[model samples]
Target: MANKFIIRWITLCIVLVVASIKPIEADSDRFNACFESCNEKCKNDDYGNAYCEVKCDFDCGAKEVSAKFNIAI
Candidate 1:
C-alpha cells in the first residue's frame, strides 16, 4: 500500500510539472511578440524604455491571466 501511494504521488507531481511547463512556453511566446512591437514603438520615441517595459508586462500578464482563467480580454 505504501508503494502504491508513493507511485501515485510521483505521478501527480509529474503531471503537475508538465501542465505548468506549457504555460511558461506560452508566456514566453507572448512576451516575445510584445517585445517586438514595443521595440518598434520605442525606436520611434513613441514611449520611453520604462513605458515599454511596463506595457510589455501588462500586456503579457493580462493575456496569460485571461487565458488561464478562461476570461475574455
Candidate 2:
C-alpha cells in the first residue's frame, strides 16, 4: 500500500509538471518577444516607450528564465 501511494504521488507530480511545461514555454517566448520589441524601441530613440518597455521586458524575461531554470535544476 505504501509503495502504491508513493507511485501514485510520483505519477501525479509528473503529470502536473508535464501539463505545466507548455505554458511556461509559451510565457518564455512571449517575454522574448517583449524584449525584442523593447530593443526596437530603443533603437528608434523612442526613449519614453523604450524606458517603460525595457523595465517591463526585463522583469518578465527574468521571471521566465528563473522559472525555466528552476525546472531544469
Candidate 1 clashing pairs, residues 3+ apart or interchain: none
Give lDDT tens digits, candidate 1, residues 1-73: 9999999999999999988785334567766787777667765876787787877778777877788779998
**What lDDT tens digits, residue by residue, belong to model 2 across residues 20-60?**
78543457567777677766767677567757676767766
Q: Which stretches in model 2 have alpha-carbon errors above 4 Å?
A: 1-47, 71-73
Candidate No. with top lDDT: 1
Q: Which has the greatest TM-score? A: 1
CA lDDT, every model vs. true structure: 0.77, 0.72
TM-score of each: 0.48, 0.34
Q: Mark the regions of model 1 whose C-alpha exceeds 4 Å error after superposition.
A: 1-26, 42-45
lDDT of 1 at 26: 59
Show the lowest summed lDDT stretch of 10 residues, model 2: 22-31
For model 2 the local lDDT of residue 26 reads 51
